[model samples]
Target: MMALNSVARADSFTITGVNGTGVTASISNYSLVGNQFTFTITNTSVAPGSTGTITNLGFALPGNRANNFTLVSSTNSNYTIAHDLNATSGSQNFVSSFDLVLIDKPNGNPTFGGGSVKNGIAGGTSATFTIAGDFSGLTADQVAHAIFARFQAVNGDGSDVAGNGTSPVPEPMSMLLFGTGLAGVAARARRRRQGAKE
Candidate 1:
């Protein structure tokens, strides 16, 4: 059984594009509790047809936050959570350094449904990650836009799939509002010009 975790108004983000098959992508969940942050990442697709399994989630910490956070534990024994990861795991590349990585062992963990020969997050299975931080504001605002996912095939046919997400994905929405405000300004300017001409 998985550990007893607080559901507590969790926040989620979408991850997509794995091996072009688009199989097993996810809308993962996360929450913060007193400087201890917990999140669940699952690989599954309801529409069917996913060829790859998610192998790891690598969080690229911003600035020099490598020492601020530490991997407390993973709910699954088949997984290993670590800090100060500067390299890539499978096909997931890191453009920045000092990452927190949760990786599925190559040996694989058995939790029913035959077995994941590749030791990845099989469809419908989830791993809740717990991370402890020394800082006070250890909220999603600090970790948003810091996540990337990796995938692989147990049979080795595929595993080089990578996906990234910004938890709140703020840019596009902010842009929309900014665009609207600019358009309004432009319209007002045009109206003033017409009044002056009159």
Candidate 2:
């Protein structure tokens, strides 16, 4: 059996295949439930004449535990360039960015995930948005947690959803376990001190 803690994680996840169109990103086998997790996607590179939109904002948390994790809310925005500089072809050049963050835990707790995007593109622009999960009904103060989540962006032709055409992998469970271990150590130390005083 494992426990949950508030320690931060050192593991990192790479948002690859996020090139031309976008990426359908998700997490799986998360032990934590009833807690909202937020993620973001940014465009690194785009075809000179290509365009797309950020929609279909939803996530799936398996285990028939809709109560575990639910898509409570989402926010997205972008900047588009009307035309190329020093050009008279009247061809509009559009550059877009995306940002997503976990503003609050599902139980209406004030906590955040990751950080925000500074620029707009994958390399140039950086956009940020957030998806809040709701875990208000859970009974325990320290509930087990895990997650399976994903998002996608598609172009006029759905075949080109991902710019690089790859998938996003889940972060390692080591950090989560490390957090549990550290908590155990702290608890043990406190217990020892209390016993000495008695």
Candidate 3:
């Protein structure tokens, strides 16, 4: 078998009953590269109501300081990043906040999934978006321990979702070590087979 240099691991979780707004959110995909974590969020309709618009999204650092977090990039152009101090104070302050607005559109409908706005995400309709950033000067274990995300939709509705237990893939060196052990076992087995044949 061909050797692998590295492997990527992903974890996901669903966010339901978001502040009782009948809108559900989920982390469809999550990955860590170095100190950066890239993730995708998918929002779906849960009950009957107007299509709730996402107002803000925030990520908390828990015990970490605000300086440890950095804003990398977002695929949505209408969203802006800022610091959210309402969640906590002092060094335990939340990392960053993303504010979203629907502009130049009638009915004030928010657009997701590459600028397609529908009346409501209800009836099995859904929208997906992505956010990525770096947690500066932190190890993989540290990053995994610090994955807490909060999101808010219009009318002061929101929800909190934690991205914990999402472990990083095994390092290339570990894979190599495992491969070496398997090779040795195979060689021994082959030698035993030849001795029996003789």
Candidate 4:
């Protein structure tokens, strides 16, 4: 349980279709700074050919871990945060599995859940959806925690992103090293002050 601060960490995971091409995807900006979280989604696949779905793509703000948060703001009125599918092109397929977990730091460990979406080839050329949610119950002390989303692609033959591994966590040694570095800097500063006095 780290102390909350003025900043919050955010991350993104892209679920590519079977063809490794783009799919129907959307993203919107949210009160990332105020609430200490933000996100974005980009469609890499062109239109009229490839397609896929991106689902279960969201993270929980560390502060609001107790009470689940939901995305209230969205670029599209019909857009929702839960399981979704995208198919605006051909046979291209984009989908995912697992849920999102936002922690306190780039290396800090946090909780996670299951989520996903399937992308297909239908609708228009491209579609975007941006959303924001209420994280009111979270304590102020947990604000600095980071945010991350677990992604996976299911079905359609061979290996898929659904089986993709989770984002790596920082090792204990790394934290120890960071602390040592900070201590060294403090010691040097103290020695310099003492030398100047003498």
Order of models, best lDDT first: 1, 3, 4, 2
Instruction: Please identify model 3 stretches exceeding 4 Å from their true place.
Output: 1-10, 66-68, 88-198
TM-score (C-alpha) between model 2 and the true structure? 0.32
lDDT of each: 0.57, 0.30, 0.42, 0.35
After superposition on all CA atoms, how large is the RMSD of candidate 3? 9.6
Q: Each prediction's TM-score against the native?
A: 0.61, 0.32, 0.45, 0.36
Q: Whole-model lDDT for model 1 versus the true structure?
A: 0.57
lDDT of 4 at 16: 41
Best of the candidates, lDDT: 1
* RMSD per model, one decimal: 8.4, 15.7, 9.6, 11.6
Q: List model 1 lDDT by residue over 1-198, tens digit each.
A: 544333433455556654465654543556667777777777664344555566666666655564566677776666665566564433444354445666555534321112233566766677777778743533454463466666555234554444454445443445777999999999999999999999
Q: Write the per-residue lDDT of candidate 4 for residues 19-56, one digit (tens) a residue.
A: 34333333323224443334444443345444333333
- Score candidate 2 by lDDT: 0.30
* Top of the candidates by TM-score: 1
